[model samples]
Target chain A: MHCLNVELGERSYPIIIGSQLLGDAQHLLPYIRGKQVCVVTNETVAPLYLSRVLEALSEFDKVDTIELPDGEAFKTLDTVNRIFDLLLERRHNRSTTLIALGGGVVGDMTGFAAACYQRGVDFVQIPTTLLAQVDSSVGGKTGVNHPLGKNMIGAFYQPRVVIADMDTLATLPEREFSAGIAEVIKYGLICDEPFFCWLEDNISRLMARDPQALAYAVDRSCRDKAAVVAEDERESGRRAILNFGHTFGHAIEAVQGYGNWLHGEAVAAGMVMAAELSHLRGSIEAGLVERVRALLEAARLPTAAPQGMTTEAFLDAMAVDKKVMDGRLRLVLLRALGDAQIIDDTPRELIEQALQTCGAT
Target chain B: MHCLNVELGERSYPIIIGSQLLGDAQHLLPYIRGKQVCVVTNETVAPLYLSRVLEALSEFDKVDTIELPDGEAFKTLDTVNRIFDLLLERRHNRSTTLIALGGGVVGDMTGFAAACYQRGVDFVQIPTTLLAQVDSSVGGKTGVNHPLGKNMIGAFYQPRVVIADMDTLATLPEREFSAGIAEVIKYGLICDEPFFCWLEDNISRLMARDPQALAYAVDRSCRDKAAVVAEDERESGRRAILNFGHTFGHAIEAVQGYGNWLHGEAVAAGMVMAAELSHLRGSIEAGLVERVRALLEAARLPTAAPQGMTTEAFLDAMAVDKKVMDGRLRLVLLRALGDAQIIDDTPRELIEQALQTCGAT
Candidate 1:
């Protein structure tokens, strides 16, 4: 088992990574502070893993479950309200713990519900997807999407614990598995150069579902993210670096419409565009962009924008992105591999050219 | 102008209490960090004071106003979403400051919108009602009511500054004005004995809208509430004392339907019930409960539950309150005139008796 603690004072919690952790009560029991528990999952994940979590929580005084519809399209305030409705109808109080038992969509929505339910309650993250385990589940950033933006409405709410069972990846579809690797690659590009080299060396082992390699990648990714998030929980300054490819990725998701493209897939392509812009800005050599593309290709992730997505569409979507400040778009461009910087003064033409370079019309 | 700071480390902000603070740009602009400003007021308050606020914000590069529908009925996630739509549609970015320019409903929905819009932005509370000025604006409790319960879905988001202009209260309806005094009296009941005495002596002057008496009451209520809030920001411990009458009050508001009885009116009646409960528990003598009723009567506030509301309704409503933990009802009762305690093991029969005693059927 691998464990990493996100060092947020008072909000600090552990990320437990191992196989079959869900069926075990030890990892899950200590973190649940309340007598009542609500397990929030999705249709797809519920069929596979919900019972194991429910079985683990059977000892609690009261246990409930709500299987939200699976997919990014279901991640909206309306969907989250369903959790609130259920919680209220069932009489879940401020002390009840909400366990998110699916992928990023489930984790994000459940965490958000916890943040808002009765003005806040405790929640645990049992992230069943690599995309969630490595990124969303650890950051304390939970929210739903608006038609105008992705993650446009949410809170920076931490969880009591994040249980990432590597065994769940066995059930993840090949495409979704590949998509998760995109964020694993992101940890390398943003702040971990040695991990980038390790990823370059171990991409096939990770793709082949090697448990040891997968666990190592998840731990390293969480450690890197925790360090950044702990420094700036609310994204006041340095924390913006975590959104390296997110601004562009959110644009792709918004223009393509949510659920059309997996978040990690859009981010894979967005990371390529960001790397290209970095090369143009003379912050990194073209070789690094190629390496990012080569690594993503090995994992079967998208290396460019979706078919027919244009620069104009990207511009319109990015205009409403949360990263924009005072009418200026703040783009997180790579100063170098393993280092990213948020720059607001990028020329509009440069951004458009980068989009064109990445196959946007 | 009297300024008091709510001492919450980085989130601490000033509450400016005085007459005509809204028309002055200096009171507002310094707290706003960005050039773009959005004033969130209601249809009722917009005609009265929105123009003055807009004029105060005229020096900003971009200024926008959203006039939400008036009353507690409009305090919903749907109404708050309107603020989000306008913010995105008008391109209000991360640095834009949202000024809530009305009563508690406006302040709550706007503050909640600011809390969730783009995962939080700067907001200022320009409370037009005495309820908001003395209580809601200073506490950082921002949320909208749910159909099942009041304040079921919300966040504990603080503001940059709270501008409580005494001038706006001139046009307030008499019933609503008395409703605000319910909270003003609450500050005395739960924490300030001397302030309670002062209210006893000066209740008529306050009811007559004497500017000095109103300012003194608002300032003292804010200070009392601020002290409790600062000690326990998220209502973990001592802060629950600040909710001395709220659980019962929320039940009244929920059972009677939200716009029928003003929040303060419901709370006024609920305070008497809590006092009755305190007397039943042998914490205080019956004289205090009678004195509570006398003071509320002097202020023209209800000192009992609505005529048709039953003990069954109170039990059903109170059962789902946020204060309930592990299926046990937690009630905040007065220990004496100016002290309160949270007790979760009160017998159900006693609670029903108190409700019946307070005019519930």
Candidate 2:
């Protein structure tokens, strides 16, 4: 078991990563602020792990559950409203803690639910997939996708505690596993060159589901993410670097529709475009961009935007991204491998050229 | 103009109280985060003050407006969703600022919209009605009402600045004027015995809309509410005391259905019931309870609960209140004319008797 703390002063919380921790009351108990709690999960995960969580929290005075449909398409205000309805119907109050018991979509919606529920409530993240365990579950960015943009509506609400149970990842689909690897690669591409090399050497071991390798990668990703979050919880400054590929990735998700491409896959392609832009700006060597593409390909992730996507569409979608400031597009571009910077002064033609190279007609 | 600061570190903002400040561009310019700004108002207020606010912000790069139906009945998630849709459709990014130009309903919904739009955005409060000027616009309590409870969905998002124009209050209806006085009197009943006495002596002057009396009341009310909010931003401790009559009042609004009785009217009756409970609990003298009722009646506010409201319905509604902790109802009850405390252990029969005395059938 590995426990890492996201040092945020009074708002700080611990992330516990281990096998078979889902049914362990010791870890989940301390975070429960009151006797009343509700576990929010998706239909896909509820039948698999809901009872385990319910049994773990059986000693609580009152326990309820809300099961939402599985998929990014279901992440909406309407879904969040349903969670609010369940909590209100059960007479849950500010003291009642909410446990998010699934992947990123479930965690995002539940954390958002907790953030807006009676102003805010304590919520525990029990992420059940590789994609969530290594990324979204670590940062406090909880929100839903809008018809116009992905994650266009949300909050920066931290969780009381995050329990990343490795056992649950054993059931993740093959494509989902690869998607999680994209984010794992991102932490390296953004800040840790050595970790990137480590991934390069051990990609197959990770693909084979080597427990030690997966644990190390998840821990490293969280530590990298935690450090960034601690400095800028609200993404007002340095935190923007963590979104190295999200700008283009979100556009793909928004243009192609949210559920069409998994978030990590979209991010994988986004990182390639960012790498291309970095090369065009003379910020990185062309060989590094090739290595970035090779890595995503090795991980079975998309290395380009969907073929039909146009540079104009990408530009339009990117304009509405959360990163835009005062009508200027602020992007996280690599200054060098293992180093990222938020740059808004890059020429528009350079970005357009990068998009063209990445199959954005 | 009298300027009072709500001392919330970094998020601290000034409450500017005076007459005829609506079209003052100088006051509104500094708070605009970006060139893009959206003004959210209501039908009733839009026809009255929208043009003035728009004229004030005409220099912004892009300006848009959303006019919701006037009244507390429209303070729902649906209305907030409409605001979100407009912002998204217009490509309003995080840099865009939102200006709420109306009474409490518009301000509360607009503030909530700002809090949830792209996670959060900047918003300024241009409160037109006395009720909003004194209460909702100051504390950053932004949210929409739910079927189960009032303010069941929202956030504690502070605004950039609050522009409370006394001129708008001149156009306020007599019923709305009376409703505003209920909150003004709350400041006195909760923590200011002297203010309570002053209100008693000057009730008729305020009722007649004397500018000096109105300004003093608005400034004092904001100061009192601001101090409490600064001490406890999320209503954890001292802030709950600020909700002196709100537990019962919110139940009144929820049971009678929100727009049926103005928030201040329900709060007026709720204050009367709280006084009755305080008397039965031996915390205050019967004479004090009579004074509370007498003062509300002087303001043309209802001093009794609605005709058909039952103690059971209030209990049912109050159970879902944000103030409830772990299924226990924690209510802010008056200890004396100038003192209030959040007490959860008060006898249920005493509360039921208090409800009965307040016209609960």
Candidate 3:
């Protein structure tokens, strides 16, 4: 078991990463402020782990469950309203605690619901997927995607605690596991060269779902993400770095239609486009771009934006991304491997060049 | 002009209560951080003042207006989403500032939109109605209502500045002007005997729309609310006192359907019921109950819950109120005419009697 603190002062919470931790209720009790507990999960995860979580929470005075339809397509305000309906129907109050017990989509929706329910309520995250455990669940960035844009509406609501049970990942699909690696690789390129190199060396073991390697990767990614989030909880300045390829990545997800490419796959490809832009700008060596592509390709993730998405479409979608500062197309580009910075001065033609090169014929 | 601070530490904001201050864009310039501005207002308020506000914001690099349908019925998540759609469509970013230019419904939806847009953005409240200028616009409470409950979804996001222009209240309907007084009178009932006496002495003048009397009432009410909010921003303790009559009041609003009875009208009746409950508990003299009824009646506000609402219905609705603690229906009851305390041990029979007597057949 590994416990990492996000260090956000009064809002600081622990991220617990371990195998076979689903049944560990003792560690979760402190975060549950009220007797009433509502666990929100997706259909896919509920069948696999609902009973185990319910059994773990059996000691609570009251426990309930609401299972949402699985997948990124369901991550919308309407779905969030369903969670609110169940909570209100059950007469849940500010004191009630909501448990988000699925991957990123469930976690984001539940956290947002908790943030808005009765103004705000206590909620804990039980991330079941590698993508969530390493990336989304740690930071207090909880929101739902809009039809027009990915994660267009959300709140920076921190959870009371995050319990990432690695055992749940054993049931995750192979493609989803690879998508999670896209975010895992992000930490390496953005700030951690050593971890990036380690990922390159251990890509096959991670691909094989080696438990020890997964644990190490999850722990490292969380530490790095948590550090960035702690420094800038609201993404005012330093936190924008965390969305390294997300400007392009979110555009990809929105353009290709959410749930088609998967968040990690889109980010995997988005990272390549950003790295290529950096190389073109003379900030990084071409070898670094190849390495990033090589790593994503090894994980079976997309290395380029989807076909039929023109440069104009990418530009249009990217303009709506949250990272577009002061109406300018600001993006996170690598100064070098393991180093990223937000740049808004990139020429429009260069952006078009990168978009055209990355898009399919 | 009366300048009052809500005293929420760094989140504390100023409430500027004055006559004809809406056109003075200098006072609004500092709160607006971004070059882009989106002013959210309701249909009722737009034709009357939107042009003036637009004129005030003419200096911004870009300014947009979204006028929503008016009334409490429109205060839903769906209506709030319309604001989000406009923001996303317009490419409003994190630095963008949103200004809410209307009564409670518009203020609330706009505030919630600002709270969720790019996680959050700065917003200024240009409260038009008497109800909003005195009550909802002061503290940083922002949210939309759900089908099950009033303000079931919301956030405690403070505004950058609140511009409560008395000039706007001139166009308010007589009922809304009286409704705003309900919250103003509450200040005296909960904590200030002098203010209660002042309201009694000046109710007619306030009803007549005497600018000075309105100014004094709005200033005093804001001062009382700001002090309480500063002490307990999240309502864990002292802040709950502000909802003294709201426990009964919100139930009335929900049962009768939102907008049927203005928020303050329901609260007026609920305050009377609460006073009756206090009388039954021997927490206060019988004269206090009569005084509350008399004040509400003098303001021409309802002193009884709407017809057809049974005790069971009220209990069920109140049970879902945000104030319900540990599954118990905790209530804010008067210890004296000018003092209130939260009591959970009030007998069920007394509560039933209060509801039965105050609710019409």
The 10-residue segment of model 2 chain A with minimum total lDDT is A145-154
Q: Candidate 1, residues B216-275: lDDT per residue as tens digits?
A: 999999999999888889888988888888888999899888999999998999999999
lDDT string for model 3 (B91-206, tens) is 78888999999999899999999999778888999999888887787667899999999998999899999988989888889898889989999989998889999888988898
Which residue pairs of candidate 3 clash? none
Estimate every model's Cα lDDT from 0 to 1: 0.91, 0.91, 0.88
Per-prediction TM-score, chain B alone: 0.99, 0.98, 0.98
In model 2, state the lDDT of residue A199: 96
Instruction: Tell how far residue B307 is off in model 3, in angstroms.
Output: 3.3
Q: Which ranking of candidates, highest TM-score first? A: 2, 1, 3
Query: Per-residue lDDT for B89 in model 2?
Result: 92
What is the CAPRI rating of model 3's predicted complex?
high
Where is the poorest 10-residue window by lDDT in model 3 chain A? A352-361
TM-score of each: 0.98, 0.99, 0.98
Residues A241-348 of candidate 2 have per-residue lDDT tens digits of: 989999999889889988889999999999999999999999999999999999889999999889889999998889889899888899999999999999999899
lDDT of 3: 0.88
lDDT of 3 at A105: 94
